[model samples]
Target: MSSGDGRAPGPLLLLLLLLALPRSAGRRRAVVNRSIPDVCATCHIHATCQQSGGKSVCICNYGFVGNGRTHCQDKDECQIGASKICGNHTLCHNTHGSFYCVCLDGYRASNNNKTFIPNDGTNCTDIDECEESGLCGHNARCVNTEGSYMCYCNDGYKLETGEHSFHQDENNVSCKEIGCGSPPEMKNGYIVGNYSVQPGSAVHYECREGFYSNEGKFSYCTENGTWEPATLSCKEIDCGKPWLIPHTTMTWDNSTTLWSRVYYHCKEGYYFNGDKNFSECTMDQSWENITYVCEEEELFSNLSIFNETCVRWQKKTGRLGVQEMYTFHVQGQRWYQKNFFHEMTFELFTHKQAPEVCLDLQPGTNYSINISMVALNFSLLVSMTTQITDPPFPEVEFVAVKGSAPLLRLRKAEDQNGPISLYQVIVLPLDLQSTFICDSFAATTFFSNTTDIKGYVAAEFQAKDVADNMSIALGDRHYYGKFYNAPLKLGQEYCVFLKIISEWNKVRTQSCVIWAQIKNLSPSLQYMTAVGLGSVAAVCLVLFLSFSVARSCLHRSVHPPPAAVACEAVHLSTTVDVASAGIASLFLETESVSLL
Candidate 1:
């Protein structure tokens, strides 16, 4: 079947001959067989040649990146001249056709913070561990840095770690307040309100009773935690009672019996109601006080008369619808002690003043006769006030707690329909000394040391109803007495004292002490004792008659009539004789029975 020497058979030769023929059997193309020009040479330096779509085309090689045909340039994926082409905070490395992105210092990436690929949806951001407050240990504040955070301690506190800050894991940071100064102690005055006061609190300091404000007052706690002004002091507040003036008796003018004007005295010549003089003392005893005061005793008297009557004289009296001129004839020799300020004043009485109502005051020596004449109504009152002023009133400013005119708040002494209410406000001298302030006065050790604690401007409030002659002492607890209801003019100024006297009792609670504020003070003050006198005399007469009737009955019972006495004796004798006869007959019967 096979030809010798591997020759093809007729059928196989015909197939080979057909395969060797051109793809088109019809015709053959005339080829200009000049050597084919190198197509790659027409392209750019970085380009290469390729045959595609039955044509020899010049193209840029895949590994060699370029823009387009005709002229091709090598593309730099690494962007060596123009940065950020890869991405910020990343290192770029040129490759065959692309670049590699490597994260730089303090940078991160979406896939991997240290290593990143270009065009990835991730950014290199700072590692802000400070976003958490507890990043640092206690009492430390966190501060963010490039890729880390820091800690710092607060003011006024110390860290136990010894450093300013420490990490949370250390567990050693603890804040403690800084040390302060030592606690302070006060003198003389104890803490007025609270003793155990803390820092940032307040403390009030005051002196003892009868003592003036020597040093301590108001103070505060410092940041160092101690009282600032810690010293205080108090001095004695006493000058015992002034010695007795010859032929004069003195008494206290307050119900407290201790807090008010100490010695209101009357000379022997002046008439006084014995019943009203409740504080007449004749003995002396030691006193118990913050400052020593003399204890008073009852007036000792052995002298007595068979009978005596009092004409109870008043120092100042209301006008009986008349004008009286009273002259104070000071001895001319005493004028040497008087100065420009030694002037007496006659203050007019009236809440509602009329310009025409004034006082005629003539301040002169004994030779000239200091006469004060006043025209007042029977319902009106007159007061003789004198003062040896210092520094003068015009120079001083008047500071009323509220104002010069205060509204009176007292029960009506009499209803508006009835007699008018009468009130009295007595303002004593500011420098009222028990010391012998006059030249002619006897030299005595009575008021030796009464410098600081003079009666702290005591006041007596009294209300009277002239119609009923009934007086009431008012200043009870209900009445707010810190305010004065006296009629004070706006432009006028005078000496005043405000400290209260602290003594045996609270005078403010006394009804009589604050009466002026309770009732309106009238310009008129009429003392009407005659109205009650008749009633008192009637009561005494009734008791006298009652005693007389009892005495007559007692006399009758003590002495019996003579005839009754004789009859009683006769009856007693007859009864005795009858008893004796009966006894004798009984004895005889007994003897006869024995014989039988």
Candidate 2:
């Protein structure tokens, strides 16, 4: 089978011929050595070795074309239109030994992959970019095209550059909302506050001073780039005639317009008792209400004092039977006691033309009574003096103790009935309790060194220093104000009296109560006697020991002359005399302590 001008077939061609032989023919030949070279190892990196007709052959990969043994170059699959190679909306890319297909911008593969091959029916489709929210800037709508998206401003909004459509890459682009210029004017009204002309903003209006409005007071911008109609309407103000007042003469002009005034005056024999004398027409379409009043010239007169503590007054002729309120102020003072003062104020209501009221006054006090008519703003002062009387009895808790001094409760005495001058606690012998007189000033203070001192004031407290349930120990030996509380005599029974004195305007009165009765008092008396005896004995022992020490010291000295001994004897005798005097003084002191 030689061709024309045929030399023996080349090596490649011969290899092809051998591969073309059938399997039966290869079986008829002798077996060759198994150490055959691998033709795939010799192929180019980009080429693959494959079996064809029982022989291994080197072939370039799908994306390349070459001789396969030495070189394989990338093939330009994209040389053909991408639409034909990778379907619509795609781009073909050639790799070293392969190729890939990618959808254009705004387009996606049916397999949802970035790159694909059409072999699996994977083609590029248009991507609905609007599905992504805010793909366009605010106030704009996104629209998808064949391979890209566009942004269009919404209604009542426009792009900054006045363009209808824009791309996301233009970051400076924005859809600004439309504005409805300035708001419409309102009749007799003016703008109130600042407002924006953009949609959904409002402009507020207010009526002028002399005008009023009952309609709406605002105009708003509509979404359609127009101002909403304002229903606000203002009208001029017109105030009516002033109101009439009783018993008043009105001085008003025929004109009853805004800011107009009407004057009023009281009739003859009447006085004005109002804050303002005129009423004015105001902006509320009516006259201003006023407090204009007229009252009798003399609301009250003919004031006099009759019953020494009662006052009487007559109302004015025009207001004879009308009910009226009066304020009474009374202040009382004592000439003898500068600090004694009393004052009171009260209101009284009566309809009688001749009204009389009795005053409650303190005894022996000079009082100035002021009766005032508050409605008439008039007051009358009268002087009066009350007669003196005995003060209220003292408040005391009577207590009796048989074995010791009583713990007395000094209840505070109220001075409502009279002025209190002093509080006295007088102690007396039990036998003299019946002879004690509250007015007797013979009782002296505890420290008064006087003979024939039958009884003394154990304590005296001022009225101000006394409290409710105050505890007072009878013989506690403490000072109360200027009075001393001396211990009671041992083995003696005593009576305690509380006396309260009231002295004002040179009038003196007093009340007394038996506060406590202490008798026997054996326990404390025994204890006192024992303490006194022990003190005296201890003193005597000390003095005797001192004297003995001096004698022993003298005796221990060396032998002395007769004259020296006589001098020593005299010294000893003087010391003995001092010791004897000291003992006697101690005994007297003990006895005195027992007598308290």
Tens digits of lDDT, candidate 1, 1-596: 56787875779777877987875443444343444566656776667667889776777765465533566655666656314665566677767655567665545665764655556566666656777657775555777777555667655555654566655555656665533343344444445666444456666777544444445476666544456765555543433343222223556443221222335344434333222322322112111111111212211112121111101122232323333433232212112122222234344333221113223332221211122223321111122222211111111122233223233333333211111212322222233423312221111112112233222222223223222333322222122232222222222222332211111111111111321111122221111243244345555554555565456546776665666545544544454445444443332211100000
> If scored against the real structure, what TM-score would every candidate get?
0.26, 0.32
After superposition, which runs of candidate 2 have C-alpha atoms over 4 Å from their true positions? 1-381, 442-446, 523-596
lDDT of each: 0.38, 0.75
Report each candidate's C-alpha RMSD, comma-separated, in the order given.
34.6, 30.5
The local lDDT score (0 to 100) that residue 139 gets in candidate 2 is: 94
TM-score of the candidate numbered 2? 0.32
The sequence of per-residue lDDT tens digits that candidate 2 reaches over residues 291-385 is: 56666555566877776678787787887678888888787765444456788989999889798899888877777666667777655546677
Superposed by TM-score, candidate 2 places the C-alpha of residue 235 at a distance from the truth, in angstroms, of 57
Record all residue pairs in model 2 with backbone atoms less than 3 Å apart, i.e. clashing: none
